[model samples]
Target chain A: MPKKHRLKRVFGAEERQHQTELLYNLTYAQSRRIGAVTVKITVEIADFKVTKDSDSVITTLNLGSCVGIALYDPNRKIAGLAHIMLPDSTNALDNSNPAKFADSALALMLQEMTKLGANKAALQAKIAGGAQMFFSPAGPASRIGQRNADTTSRLLRLYGIPILGQDVGLNYARTVELYSKDGSVVIKTAGRADKAI
Target chain B: MELFTLSDVHYEIMREIGNIGCGHAVSALSKMLNKKVGMKVPQVKLLEFGNVAGFVGGPENTIISIFIGISGEINGMILFLTEQPSARVLVNMVFGTPKNTELSFSEMELSAIQEIGNIMCSSYLSSFASLISKSISQSVPDMSIDMAGAILSVPAIEFGKIAEHVLFIESVFSTETDNVSGYFVLVPDLPSFKKIMSALGVD
Candidate 1:
């Protein structure tokens, strides 16, 4: 498909090889036939994925104090998912990866989604994770989960992207999946029922 | 100083800290369980934030973690973690429950695990404190059963604020019949790290 070709053209040789390896890793990536072939793309920590393929499902796992944001353009069926680790990029030890911070991750995701022919005005967002896995009596660092969720929500508002759904800020970890076909978000946590939002 | 800039001597000192600290902890665990507890030599490493989760078992692996924050003389975070099955085994050993019995982590079981974490961490910290002659205090232990990556993110985020590289001391402790290997992770802040090195007369 043209979308697949575009993906190959967009990623470098090494990144393409990494994607190929991910595809072949059946334990992490699951494929299904839903009228058309569907493939899952895993967005690891500090990573993001944007695609116009309707049969693509972008997922990020084990979001504890981190946050996952999913953006979808209804008309064009373009989707983006970012697994953001920190609230801000300022004073970060490593700022090379734009997807690692809430502020920059949204900016990068929006740029990539627009490049994939998605209408910026039609983009809607769903967010998950930002859970407080541990309680600490220290300073702000103990509440980093709440900070990450707040920062991501603020950035989304700045981008004029309406947040359609969210499941954030609990004492549990989450795994999130964003479906491009229907712009739906599913949240999974251990010992809990999977939630679709 | 940057973690990468640390020389071999610094690493060796850190490793010794791990060795002494974990040795004390394993013995405390042995006393509690009333059985011989075996341990591997502690390892000290400087790792990227992303790679820290892989040590416990890939990022997504399910784990039970106990988190304790250290303050006063040496500021840092300490974590004791094990896979779900290993957690069950450790808890059962404490309760004298049959090894094959399943655990749903009832309130009593959860408290037992927390107490074990408290004892082990305090023993480890006490040894380090006495070694440096610095007074340190630890926060109450908090427990979570979740994905390793998620649990590890707490320390990773804290360390990320000061450096791209995270320095950690890890020790694995096991028991007989069931190899209930538990990992002890220590992440000290930059200033505290410096204090430790200076206290040990390293630099």
Candidate 2:
């Protein structure tokens, strides 16, 4: 195992608002992002992108599957989220529509953010989702969640962008929040409260 | 007159209709995923329509059942499954890698099943809509990683009658990298059975 693959953890609720570090528990709203113009991106079998200049983008990647939420806040206030499933759309798309894949989803999200005053060069990214929610020996397509995470990271690199932070490749589903106001995010998983980063 | 015979054109038509309806579902999924999904028409069996659970032994045969239900003018469940090893393969294909193996039993073990179920159910229902020519909506899928028997028992099978015609369709989806196989079965009442047979040019 490489040093980079080691799990990374962050301590939460040490400072800031009490509301910032919500205990990760199921009884709560699961995961949330508090900010203006919150664009909620939900991924089913399909991927979608939402951009907002006011609020952050809140997306849920629950257990039993893999989901990738790509949030870009180039202005540090304007944010966008792309809830993506499959890693590649090559097999998932009809050839006429390329934006359906993870790589395409990120491109589209960035394009949207750019339209909303986000600088492509200044764009910083946070990626969450891509859990090993299931073990299928069949191959990568069966573990769409992992594919979501891997493909997302790959696409980000292809565009010559740096990933500042990522919480991915776990065995649990996660809910992600992108706060546009402060350019922070909170990830909540089962049995734990929300932790903002 | 033979009450129950192959010559009973209605049964034949019902089988054909089941194949057509399920084929649409396969076609829809194939188009969306850009992969070919194969299907098999269900062999008609006679059992208490309502006692489907008893016949199938509910949770016993089930490894994990992931499904979503649609409640409106019509109600139906979309489901998917695989034996343990098969599930592993299915998961890897979906996630685009090999299994982590370290935390295979964790909650993450259910993600692939749920995701696949969601896709299948949505496509199946959409296909059904085309066949019936009726508008139908679906609730978000409810996925459960439970014993096959337990999940099967959740639905009461005793609402209808015994020995009604049932249709089963099996589909196999093969991609350059992997393959997925699934089945679709329809249990229609007698009158509906007759209508289906006529639709299939059987009766």
Candidate 3:
């Protein structure tokens, strides 16, 4: 059986259609051909991806209170991006996905990068998102954006990974892209100029 | 009890709750806009963290959202979301501007939108509270114009700390113009879910 037929059989018609739409938005494969090969990977909420492909561009979209951390080893041309929702995993009721928390996600991404021939000493980070999004009185549920940024910074410092650039602590959403080739991070927001950090 | 393990009966009850809540909200909106409003049947679903963004188009789709915190008998959040065009239409209706007038959410307009959301939420909560014989209050409404996924993440992260899945009571409301439609989502936490079920005399 063809691959498409097998996927349809497993996922059914509706799921297959949804997957196709996701693929179209994620890859833009036909329209975004840079040179002979260009790979695009989308990191959804509470997910992480690490790649050493020089032609790859990894992206995470609509980061509200959540933070997107991009770590790149310029020496090895390896890049890793993690979209984490919360500050810590210790208090999570379901801690199955390590990528959902700042503390564990950074550690996991670093480990993955090192496994793919990236040097820990040469890893640098670029971070974005962590917007407050909405206003609420001071409480445990408030300032989640600040907490996520603080936790991510603290963990990176402890890991000896310097944050080279960042765009955080605002009142809007952000879309982030990390390029593996040159270790550049771009931040995009609605009705605003794209910033390269 | 786990949210995903809820039975069909529980979902049916949830559907009724959504129906009543949205019915009240629609009337409130209709009164505010002085236009005829209609609502689709409410949908109650237990959704994974990742799929919640799909409800309002997609993760990257830009939208106008209002957030209100629920307290008192239960603790949770309510989100009101509408596309840019729909938001423009609603704002225009409020200001009696031409239907095609552009809206950049000026201070006056923002406050108007916030008030609209506040009234709609209060009506929905009032109906729900009365139905369950509970007293619930809502926080001041906060508004944001951003990507749907970003707006949704606020509630997703809050709920993620307590459960793997979110139980959402989703209702879509539209006006006679048909170009104006909005989504209202109610997300109750695990303990609150239990409280609600028991209050409704359901196990």
Candidate 4:
């Protein structure tokens, strides 16, 4: 049995209880402890937005050959995440928002984050996901995960957003969670411990 | 317009054809999934695209629609899914899970389904190609999960008549302890429709 599934089976019951408690705490604290925390984050195709009033985790789960961007502003403690499925907008049927693709998503995300009190210069990022889940022996273009990761890295460099951390090009899907309350980000991959930043 | 009619012999031939087509599809799925998938040759019937939803029964009628084109020949929609459980089972089987797990689509499941859809659609087309002795290709299949009525409610185009021709087949499969069902929907172009109908004596 794979480590993740085995762990899940062994700790599934206990984890369920903990998850329930975590959800409860997050829900209750959103109002009581996290003052003015609205948890208001929009699930945009490519870009996401967050504000200081948001105290809830913003995330997208199980990204396959898709790039997920998590941007945090320590000054304002606001974070945003988006799971981009394709590399470019040209392949998509709806291209109204080019940002829905990897290249454009990062550009739009940085642009929006700056508008929401995020410093363009001090904007830190931790990206995870862009896994080659399919059985593709062919390199790069055929591998959407590579394309997603490559596109994200290229765009970030072009725009000059310093990448603080990265975990990309794996064979498993990952779930991303952003803690708006403290500007913390968590990435959970198959058979691996949750990494936080 | 004189509606086409099928003779008893033609019906039997077409049913066999449907079964063969479904079998080829299951074979492709088995290869792609790299697991044992037992699927019975579907039972084919002619019905209005609207009424077709009723035959696929469940508490909440949901259907997944995909569009496939035979390059420049036929452009048709394929819809399936008897219920949510069936969809889950499909996702599980495609992932090669031996023990039945409560299937929830993660990112892997989405891409897996896209590839499976491609294989199944190709299998179905190949089977039809053999019977008709002609070539057929399909576009990338689109996946949508919605209430049957909502999926089929495309205003005035309900009665299968408007669509050059329609073939409805039910596919049944079982995994470990769970048994599930789905449908194979095919819409043939005018020329291919006439060929199939004529071979079956539907005129």
* DockQ of all models, two decimals each: 0.46, 0.01, 0.50, 0.02
Name the runs in model 2 displaced over 4 angstroms: A1-45, A61-65, A74-76, A91-99, A139-141, B1-203
How displaced is residue B111 in candidate 4, in Å? 20
Q: Which 10 residues in a row give candidate 1 chain B its minimum summed lDDT?
A: B95-104
- Model 1 lDDT per residue over A116-154, tens place: 999999999999988898988784348889999999999
Model 1 quality (TM-score): 0.88
* Model 2 RMSD in angstroms: 17.9
Top candidate by DockQ? 3
- Candidate 2 lDDT tens digits, B30-65: 675566666654455553222333333342344445
What TM-score would each prediction reach against the true structure? 0.88, 0.43, 0.89, 0.51
Q: Write the per-residue lDDT of candidate 3 for residues B70-156, one digit (tens) a residue.
A: 888788888888887887788888888865657577888888888888888889989999999888877888888888888888888
iRMSD for every model: 2.0, 16.0, 1.6, 13.4
For each candidate, what is the lDDT? 0.84, 0.50, 0.85, 0.56
Ranking by DockQ: 3, 1, 4, 2
RMSD to the true structure for each prediction, in A, is 6.8, 17.9, 7.6, 12.7
Per-residue lDDT tens digits of candidate 4, residues A24-115?
45554443463423343444224455555555668655544556787777777767676665666655544555545776677677767777
What would the DockQ be for model 1? 0.46
Error of 2 at B130 (Å): 28
Q: Please say which candidate is ahead in TM-score: 2 or 4.
A: 4
lDDT per residue for candidate 2 within A17-48, as digits (tens), equals 23333333222233334321133444322345
Give the clashing residue pairs of candidate 3, or none: none
Off by over 4 Å in 1: A1-36
